[model samples]
Target: MRGTVAHLVPVADPDEVATIIAASKRAVGAAVESLHFPLVPGVAAAIAETDNAWRALEAEHGLLDAAAVSRMLGSRGRPGALANDRRSAGKLIGVRRRHQYLYPGFQFDAARGRTRPAIPALIAAADDAGLPHDELALWLCEPSGQLGGDRPVDRLDDADAVVTALSAHVGVQW
Candidate 1:
C-alpha cells in the first residue's frame, strides 16, 4: 500500500476559489473527453441539474455535514483493491460529526456512530470527475475557520463557496 496521508486546507478568497475551480473543470473536461463517452444529449443537462442541486444545498444549508457530503459524493466502497484503488486515487475517509447549534433540543445522541469525514468523499468525487485532485484535497483539509476574522457564518460561507466552486468545476448537473 502507498500509505500516504495528507490534509487539505480551505481557501480564503472567492476569486482564488473560482480559479481553482476553473482549473479543476478543465481537468475533468479533458478526462471526459478522453473517455469518449459519446457526449450523450442529456449529459450537459444532467450536469446542470447536479450543479443546481449542489448550489441549492450550499445556498440553503451551507457546507453539508460530513456524512451528507460523503453521500453526495458516493464515497462508498466495495472492499479490497477496489476500495484501495479508490483511496489511492484520492478518496476520503474517517468522517465524524461535530456539534452545531442548528438542531435545537437535539442532544448528541451517542448511540449513532460518529459521522464519517468528508475529505475522502470530496477526493473521490474529484477523482471520479477527473478534477484537480490536489487542489480539491487542499481545499478540504486547510483550516480556514479563522480566515474571515468575523462570525462563524463567514467560515461556513467560505466552505460553501469551496463546495460550490468544486461542483461547478466538475460540471455536476443534479
Candidate 2:
C-alpha cells in the first residue's frame, strides 16, 4: 500500500522505491498468512462468510464487468470504455468495488444487445429523487414491500410498475 511505501522510502528515488516495494510485498504476504492463523478462526470465518455472500449476490444478479458490458453494447468483442462513460454520466448504475465497477446484468436487454430502454429513465428518476447510486443497487436487488415483494431488478422491463414502486419508495413522483 502507499502507506507502506511512504513510511520506508523516498517515493521519488527509484532505487529506494523498488527496494521498499519488495519489502512491502514480503510484509503483505506475511500479513496474508497471518490472516488464516489458528488463533483467528472467528475472524477468518467472518471474512469467508462475507466473501461468500458477495459471490452469491454477484452470481444471482449476473454482475458484469465493464468489458462484458462493452460487448453487450455491440462493441465488436472488444472491451471499450462505454460502460464507465455511461456510469459517469449517470445513465448507468455501476456498483463500485475496490478498483472497478460491476454493472448489474438486468440493465441489459440480451435479445437486443443493448441496455433496456427504460434504464436511463430509471436512473434519471433516481437522480431526480436524490437516491444515491450505491443504495439504488441494494434497493434494486432486494425484495420490496412497495413492489409486492419482488426485487426491482426483476421487474425493470415493466417501467411503469417499477417507476411507481420507486416513487413510493423514495416519496417522490417519477
- Compare the candidates by lDDT and give the number of the best one: 2
Report the C-alpha lDDT of model 2 over 49-122, residue by residue, as the tens digit: 45544555677767799988987887764475888888888777888766789887778887898887767877
The global C-alpha lDDT for each of the candidates, from Candidate 1 onward, is 0.42, 0.75
lDDT of 1 at 53: 44
Question: Tens digit of lDDT per residue, candidate 1, span 6-100?
Answer: 11113666677677667767876786788745777777556655555434434443443443433333556432333334334544321112442
The true-versus-predicted C-alpha distance at residue 160 of model 1, in Å, is 32
Worst lDDT run of 10 residues, candidate 2, spans 1-10
Candidate 2 wrongly placed segments (more than 4 Å): 1-54, 76-78, 172-174
Clashing residue pairs for model 2 = none
Measured against the true structure, the TM-scores of the candidates, in listed sequence, are: 0.25, 0.63
- What is the alpha-carbon RMSD of candidate 1 to the true structure? 17.0
- Candidate 1, poorest ten consecutive residues by summed lDDT: 101-110
